[model samples]
Target chain A: MTPNILEVQNLHFHYPDGSKALQGINMLINENSKVALLGPNGAGKSTLFLHLNALLKPCAGKIRYKGADFEYHKAFLKSLKKRVGIVFQNPDHQIFSASVKQDISFGLFNLGYSATEAGARVEEVGEKLNICELFDKPTHFLSVGQKKMVALAGVVVMQPEILICDEPNAGLDPGNYKILMNSLDTLYREGCTVIISTHDVDFAYSWADTIFILDQGRILKQGTFDQVFKDRRILEQAKLKPPWVFETWEKMIDNGMVSNILPAPRSQEQLYNMMSDRRIMKRTTPKIIEYQNV
Target chain B: MSPNVIRIDHYAYMSPLRNVHPGEKIFFSLSTMLLVLAMDSILISGIVLGVMSLIIVWRAGVKCGYFLKLLAIPLGFLLLGCLAVLFSVSSEGADYDYFIKVGAVFIGVSVDSFWNAVQLFTRSLAAVVCLYMLILTTPINHIICILQRLGVPAIIINLMVLIYNNIFLFVRSADEIYIAQVSRYGYHGWVGQIRSLSLLCSNLLVKSLKASNDAFNGMISRGFDGELKFVDEVFETKAGNIAATVILNCLLITIYLSGRV
Candidate 1:
């Protein structure tokens, strides 16, 4: 649908010990959509990511990128990998270069860019990521936030159209997390498809254009935040709570403050404005209506 | 084991030696070791050792005792050198004119052999200390950078990099092992500790393998080709670094030549 950039058809994946990591599943990611893959621990969110870049082979399904089946072709898979860059959860595991500059240039070198082109790309991304100070510094010496930034810069320099990051904000400080989210916004604006697997519900609600709810190796629901998270039963089944803002909106709706919750406000400004509207007199009436049980 | 070892990685500690290229440091070490090995007499070695020690103090600002503790490692050589000179002296070649026995006791030994041993021991010790300062003060990355600039094969440089990385990884593994043992029963006793030790060893091996696999995955994901293309090339060498390195080399050469006697 909507010119899917990534199409997953009835995928199944299993570990060597016969543990299923991804049950029979199907999904499609529209071009330029910033999506979040949300799930609890052991929910196979990471396994789903590995399949995106062809890092983990599918057991019984096909992944097609740009309308080309990538199931059997090695060259296609390699090209797919180049197009879809995955920033791993562990920055330490991902960063193998001696210096920040080298780490960024690593992918470009692999992509067979000329020395001049790779160097230019490295400089550009290093500047964009605010890592100009770290270009010469050793990777090991960098702080966790700096390391993650360096790792992200490394992947970004390759100019991938699709970015799939697994738990990118797992150990981030608020400042670094905001910086990363801002960068993701920037990347989305640049027409890159951004996919983040996260447990940060607020981040997903605020940032993602589409959200995929994963549970027990399956994608149970996929839609805009309002569509996926509006169902409290589904939320409970997935073992996740809706974002605080979403919860507030639901409370306002049950109190007859509004006829319905405005489609999960994507920004604080939008939520603030919608709540403060005087035209909705019902919203102005404090404690006027009984709130509904979820 | 010392906090200083960790602190040594900080820039303030390394600032003095950062100016010298790793190749230059290696060269100085080689020359000093050669001079120590080639010397036949103790007097020349002692003077050479003294000169080297003075240069280390002047350049690196390191203390004599810190280095002496390190030199304590090769003290066996000092003992052996002294013993060899003492026992190998030809009876006919004895320089002492009077074999004086003070009341049926031969108490005094030849001064020549004793001085020779002292010279040999101190000179070799000094050389190692200078090299130690060179390594301890210069960052490993800079050293690798210098080596790359000096036209070393990319493969060799890469191997050195992997080895350096592995040492840190090994340290991390050791730390994890220690924590795991402490968490489970608090490292109680020696014999019972076998379980923890074995677990640590196995876990370390597994982690190393997993790390290598992850490294391979990262390399593949990032488009790592065979040759390591430098992201940031060494554009220029600092004048102060070059000047210091040249002066140190000159001083080392002078000490080495003086040690020939």
Candidate 2:
């Protein structure tokens, strides 16, 4: 098996207000994988994300990067943060500078890059994200979708190995949603490990290589998308319904419309293809003739 | 957005001179203001005000009506101040050229006091016009960049940046809460309005604190240390523009000095 890029072993965390945010969480995140964390509200997904980024140290247990135990010292943290970049849920919470160019250059500067190098990276990332036009605009006047794009650009400019986003699609309109999803897809294609915590089951089911069902500060189940979604108990415990595509496939199989057993389709296109294949088979099949009718 | 903030920001971002170097604008505004203050001549003050008003309306593309509206904001206070300087209350009217008798007292304006009041009003108005011209042409982001270039301490600069960005956030959150409350009939009456407003203020404060904590965590996750560093776009400084600014200020000063002589 390939070595895990990140490992969480028996991790636990508590808020300053004395609430347990994470409880004995364990997982191995493979490199270059698209991972989705799904849960109801207050399920500690955000808490775990913070721990992954080292913004919050686990009260117990440890986090491992590559094969080594992750250190929490100042020097190590600076390097760790460079490898693990997180975009917060609210753009208002993440964007600090009124100038878009300045905000995008923030992480590069913290990484000790010279101004010229930082400027080049900002331009590159801005073009990749299609936000080069906003470089000179004031962030305050941007719409919510634009601010969200700026916030994502701020972190993407850092070029982290692992990109964790907390609800990247929350509150986005359809057009902005497509833009964000496309951007994440581009990053994933570039061999970046992308982790997203979302409430949209359909999106996770279709997009993720791995799905983690989190409930009440514990990861209820973690496996390949099919393995986790096929388990009714885990879905119930996580307070989530099966993705619509999975549900429709299951119903078709039960009603004998599809006789051949197949794995659940990951997307609407895949499901359509499966159904079309059945229609094509029927069309090419030989038909019986009745001589008495002639 | 509040109408006032929207108006100012709209003009600042859309101004025809927005692409010009901020330093030149700042230099012209500040130097002209200093001349107005030092010379204290009505002629100099009037000329300064007229020039700034013309630039703001014509060159900056701001409407003349809007400029007059902004000017009216401080005119009320100036009039109050000028009235205080013009009117004197005394038991005897011997020292005054004109007086109004109340009962046993006299209140009136003298020629000298009237002249002083006029100069004070115009001077203050001229100073306000200078400041407005600067603000109306240059966005706050450019101003902050200029301040950073001038070596403002990191702590103050960071604070200013955060505050400026969060003002919109706070305003948005506050507006959302206010709308929710109004929908629930929280402001149907006088007492309800007071209660709802107070509740909105407290909720906004809590939200702002939460937002600040989130912002700090986000910063840390991006490798933020004690200092904040950002790249600023290099603005081209034209010698011709600089020379023009200098010549205009010199002309204003020459006019003032010639009048003095």
Candidate 3:
């Protein structure tokens, strides 16, 4: 069994403007899992991530990292921050240095690495992110996609155990989107627990092993995609649509076009394969369609 | 394809001397500037301006046209300053090489004052060229690093870095806003332009505040720890760099002693 890398319990938070941002949030994120937080705008996804990274103290509840409660002492917060890196959505906000290499090295230096070691590490991360050519590029001249990659490089070099990204996929073109996803997959395979908050249902459906549906400052449901998404009520309440692949697969199954399957298909290729299973001409169980109705 | 606001910085990053030790560049530029100011020789100042401009265009990869445009920025102010030295008003007009009498006073240019103004103008121009060489060859972070090594306070250095980073962003933002306003005929008339400029300024103030707040949060998320730390760019001092600095300064000293530019 995988260890729970991060746990949030009954967390409550409010903005200084007297608006509730997060309420009674509980979560269990295991090591090496790809988790996606899905919600509409103003649903408190970013607010929740800030809490997870220890950037914000919850108003009513507490968080634990690796089963140890978070202590707000200076040293403890510093250490915790080094291990849990948060990549903000805007690269401009994150990149404070005019030089790309300098910006990327900011985190490594804060972690107390030596000059030679930090330089090598920054170079290595640049190569890993396929931004090697941009090492000496000025941050201001970079395209939005390039800046986003640079921002990701800065945080990823810290080698955080749990990397949280708020809308990492925002503003990326198709080519850069593929590259970013590939890099995230590479990081995940290398034993980093990657978490992202995105408005892309198709991306979350196909990529994440676990999904947390957030709505109105509350978690509507948290489970595997099939368990959480199979229940249409929670998705509707959360103001999200089912991924296109799942939606099509479900409609075909409703028309007696596929067999009863335990786990629903998450991707287009998976749905295609499921369609050609040759045994999929049978009707699905009423348990799913009936449950989806209610 | 980059914006015009960071044109100098763009040249700096792309400079062939970019990877050279900042200490060497800083030392060379500062020494040259001081010599130009102290010698007060028109010939030496001309030599300094010519050599620096040549290096900036040929070695630094900046276009000559842009370099001249940058040099032209202070031409008006320099002329105005030189004007004060060039013209003298006197009741007698005794020492004047040429004089124009206006009412009871004569405004004239004297031979000595003419040489003095020429020297002053050339010296100031040479000093500015020397500084431009430093700016065009070295990125700001390196300058900040040099200051840090020289024991500049952290607060000031941090402020410099933050301001440096945000300057380009705000320039681009203002440019974009200007274009957006122009699209709607915001600057069609003087009154309209004033109104548009006021609106843009107010809008920018709010946006800059938000951007700074967001930047602060971004830094905090990265374990900022009330300090800004970074891995200084790696540069190795070579014998060639040291020798070049020595030879260059020695030649300048030789020219000063010879009283020939």
Instruction: Give the CA lDDT, 0 to 100, for residue B26 in model 1.
Output: 60
In order, candidate lDDTs are 0.71, 0.83, 0.82
DockQ result, candidate 3: 0.01
Cα lDDT tens digits for candidate 1, B84-189:
7554323443454334445544433467656666666666665565566566557777677767777889999888877766666566656544532331222333
Native contact fraction, candidates in order: 0.00, 0.00, 0.00
Model 1, range A67-171, lDDT digits (tens) per residue? 888763545644765788878787765665456776677566555578899898889987787889998887667889998998788778877899888899979
- Candidate 1: clashing pairs of residues: A107-B222, A110-B223
What tens digits encode model 2's per-residue C-alpha lDDT throughout A48-85? 99788876789999999997788867567667777888
lDDT of 3: 0.82
Off by over 4 Å in 1: A259-262, A281-294, B1-261
Please name the candidate that would achieve the greatest lDDT relative to the true structure. 2
What's the CA RMSD for each of the models?
22.0, 22.4, 22.9
The TM-score obtained for chain B by all candidates, in the order given, is 0.62, 0.83, 0.89
Candidate 1 similarity to native, TM-score? 0.53
Interface RMSD after interface superposition, model 3: 17.4
